[model samples]
Target: MIKHRLFWPTASLLALLLGNFIANPGFFAIELRDGHLYGSLIDILRNGAPLILIALGMTLVIATGGIDLSVGSVAAISAAIACLQISKLGDQNSISGMLGAMGIALALSLVLGAWNGLLVAVFGIQPIVATLILMVSGRGLAQLITEGQIITINSDPYKAIGAGFVVALPLAILIALTVFVLISLVVRKSALGLLLESVGGNPEASRLAGVQSRRLIWLTYLLCGLFAGLAGLMLSSNVSSADGNALGLWMELDAILAVVIGGTMLTGGRFSFGGTLIGALLIQTLTTTVYRLGIPPETTLLFKAVVVMAVCLAQSPAFRRKVLGRRKPKPPAQASQTQTKVEIPA
Candidate 1:
């Protein structure tokens, strides 16, 4: 347990939860009311659902030796597309209308993702640089979609995606969980996970071994874009509106942080879906804890930084060795004196 990659992040999340429970006795209390379960824990999962999705997607991309810096922008654009389409509907309450809007948005997301994949995999551009181009232009495209205005709607089905409850659990949480499980099964049950790690660990070697490295890389970016779109949908639906400028602003940072906290290396290779889940919950809990404890809003970023740094340091082998102070062996005690048999042999 001490040396496992999951040990530190899991410990950190539990410690945070325990501290909150200590500070507020009801932190873990869940209540059943109006056919819905409610509590601090529920809120964390509900609010962190989008983050979990994006982090999962980011994990895949990072595992393929690539990064998607345009997730936030892509999310904003997606929300704008969905909301705008729904706003134009004559019957906003129509489930079919909402589905159609979502389809259009998700399709656009895939295209954008494919564009990014093309840049990085086919054109041989740096992942960061390739994604950056979209990162800069996506916001403008979102504005264009929304005509520089916030698109609002009154579709219950659409709202349900983000805020509704299913079997007393938030629907958002269920969606994220479902996606996580499906993705996990797909990648793990087959050779896909190993292939991704191989490509990430050494692209040239993977290629020489007959792996289609570029296709794999492109696939990961496409997945990232798709998840970012889903996240945008949940975010905009929660508020029943999409403000292109603010829909997914700065969310890419949180997704990246969550992936990192989950023990996925920025350099790519192996990854942990379970770790990303815990990391996402930890981040959401931290934010809630800050407000619950009455910390100044201005210092929220600082507080998060401290906690993240502490957890990362806790996970570091060098840091642990420094703190624990490795004791040098007593030179095996020199056996004090050799037995007389040694002298006879000489």
Candidate 2:
């Protein structure tokens, strides 16, 4: 099963975990506290929730032979909208106000998703350029919403979205897990997965075969925005503040990296949710390792770059052959009879 798509990502995740364990023995230790599990491993799940959610959405987008570079900006806008709503409310701490703010954020997310869909699916704009339009302008929209200021809120229920515990696990983790399961069911339980692969593998073929290619692609972008909004909510809730400028900066890149490392081809065709999940975890583990090992803050990026490059090479069949050398084919066997010594004429 070494050739299996999930195998390498899974192995990488385990290797990262093992490295963490070596650097800090407590990395794998989980303890009970207030009826909840607590540990570095749990922390990884908690902190990585936003990336996990975004990566799930990215997986779908990539599966349709498209990329959403605006996911990060969508996240910023989501946080801005939610935080702005709450800041203007009479009771910022009220659960009703928080819910209303969340609703507004999600509504705006749908609009943004539709906007991207319109540009790409309807207008026939290239996915990268279409998404780049929002990628640049969305942060400006977020800045406008917050009036070039960081919006902060003080609400326990709101904070609970990012920090609370449910069934002895982080709420963010639970939310991500629920989304993953639902999407997995929707995509894998039916022919949707095949249709998506067909479209990505060959849009013209899929279209000729009666697949509504535009609708499918549009829907993928919509879902990507939806999940980015959710991730924004989790991030703002965690900090109780929304920094339009800094929030979700470069998150799209991270999501893309996670998607690639998960064995989803950049060209798009097939994908693995399990691999994506492990890839997200691997990234978080790498970050944690950097800090645990006391690596210089300035060099962290370089270190991550090296590790990520190694992973990419490991996953590349051509790179593997180049580095490890290909095996030679076996020669044909000779007959056991007396004619074995016969040679071909020159």
Candidate 3:
């Protein structure tokens, strides 16, 4: 089952790489300059890392059959808050001020996460409706933080958070790896994974089993928000600007696509964090491939749509049975002359 679960995404990624290689032989090169990795592959990995982090959290939420549409907005808000704080520390401010801003941004993210939890767990509101409220308002709040202005900071420490490298690998990749490991440990080492799957598979059954389904759902969203906050910080750090409108624009879709492509069902139940990582990488690779091939950027969305449709169709049981059912063996026919032949022999 595990092998089968991984087959589609793996195959798709392999095919994509092969196609890109055919189009451009230079797609696989990795170069290091000035102690930093530089390559098309590295760029894809770096750019995709934030989405991988967000998708990691989304995997847990989707496992409980819930969606957090507010993640993109949460990211924007986090970035704005972080940038606003850093802006307070003039361009000449010391590293300590930058570090203080990061701390504040992280704290605010946790608070927002807790707010999401309270609404869904305590108020019992539908996940979609509850998250949507923030999805719309969160951006506004981010804009308000900057007073509708884009605050650009020229701090090296802040820039390093996004664009810096550690041991030749992008810092974003490291952050993504850390988050992946932490979340994996929490889910697999504890009862959380089983509880989440059970709730997603059948909420009523889980409730009867004494699982705190609502609390579980709420916590998942909170985690999603928290990750979104991290992603926002990474994004703003990369550009050194808090443009709320462009911070995490439409990233919720990408995160959802990563979750779905990772083999997590939209209805929820079982989820694969590793699969989400693969999915994020695949998406980034696709975009990079398109750009390298000189294809119009707008066409990338169409490609994404097609891939998503194909994955959804492949996962549908009805579609699989329909395609597989035709190959079943038919019963053999009885011979009509067998009795006559036996009688003659007798």
Candidate 4:
């Protein structure tokens, strides 16, 4: 079943790469210059890292049959908070106060995550509605943090978090991998993954089995918020500016797309973290291919929509059964004749 589930996306990705390579022979060239990886492939990995991080959290949240519509706003809010702190340190003191700024930004992100959890778990609010409140207000809060102004800073340490590379690989990819492994350990190796699946598959049954469904739901959202926070920091670090209005706009959709394309159902129940990573890479590669082909940027969204539809259809049970049913065998004419003869003799 797992093999069946993974086949389509894997095949599609391979085909995409093959097509790109055929079109542009230079697509696969990886050049290491001055201790930094420079190549079209590296660029995709770097740009896709933030979405991968967000999708990791989204996978957990979706596994429990819940959706988080507020992640984009959370990212914006996190960026605003981190950049505001850096701005306060001013250009001269930014380097001297790096630790303090990071600590405070992390704390604020946790608090935001906790708030989302409380609303959904304790208050018995629907995940969509509960997160919607934040989706709308979080950006306003972020704007308030920056007083509706874009705070730009020239901090070396902050830049390293996003744009810097270690051993010719992007730092963002490293961070994404770390988060992925950590979450995979907790969910797959620990009881959390099973518990989440139970809740998603049948909440009442999970509750009857003594699983703390509410608490799990809350924790999932909280973790998702934490990831969004990290993603926000990475994004802002890349630009060295916090533009709350634009930092993570529409990113929630992208994260959700990655989760769905990775074979995690939007209706939620089962999820695949590794699959989510592949999905993120696939989306990034498609975007890069589009640009390399000289297609208009506006058309990329349409292409994404098409790919998403294709994936969803391919994953659907009805579609699979329909496609497979056509391959079923038909009885041979000789076998039918023999059966008729036997029936007549009897």
TM-score of each: 0.94, 0.93, 0.89, 0.90
At residue 222, candidate 4 shows an lDDT of: 86
TM-score of 3: 0.89
Candidate 3 wrong stretches, greater than 4 Å:
1-3, 91-93, 315-346
Using lDDT as the yardstick, the better of models 3 and 4 is: 4
Would you give me the overall lDDT of model 1?
A: 0.92
* Residue pairs in candidate 2 whose N, alpha carbon or C atoms collide under 3 angstroms: none
What lDDT score belongs to each candidate, Candidate 1 first? 0.92, 0.90, 0.84, 0.85
Model 1 pairs in collision: none
Residue 29 of candidate 3: its Cα lDDT? 84
Q: Return the lDDT, model 3, position 229.
A: 87
What is candidate 2's lDDT per residue for 1-346, written digit by digit as tens?
8778778888888898888887678778999988999999899999999999999999998998999999999999999999888888887789898999999998899889889988989999999999999999999999988889999888888899999999999999999999999999999999999998988989999999999989989999999999999999999999999999999999898888888999999788999898888888888888888888999999998998888888878888777777788765679898677655778899
Ranking 2 against 3 by lDDT, winner: 2
Runs off by more than 4 Å, candidate 4: 1-3, 90-96, 323-346
Q: 216-282 in candidate 3: lDDT tens per residue?
A: 8878877887888899889998998889877888888889988888888889898899889988898
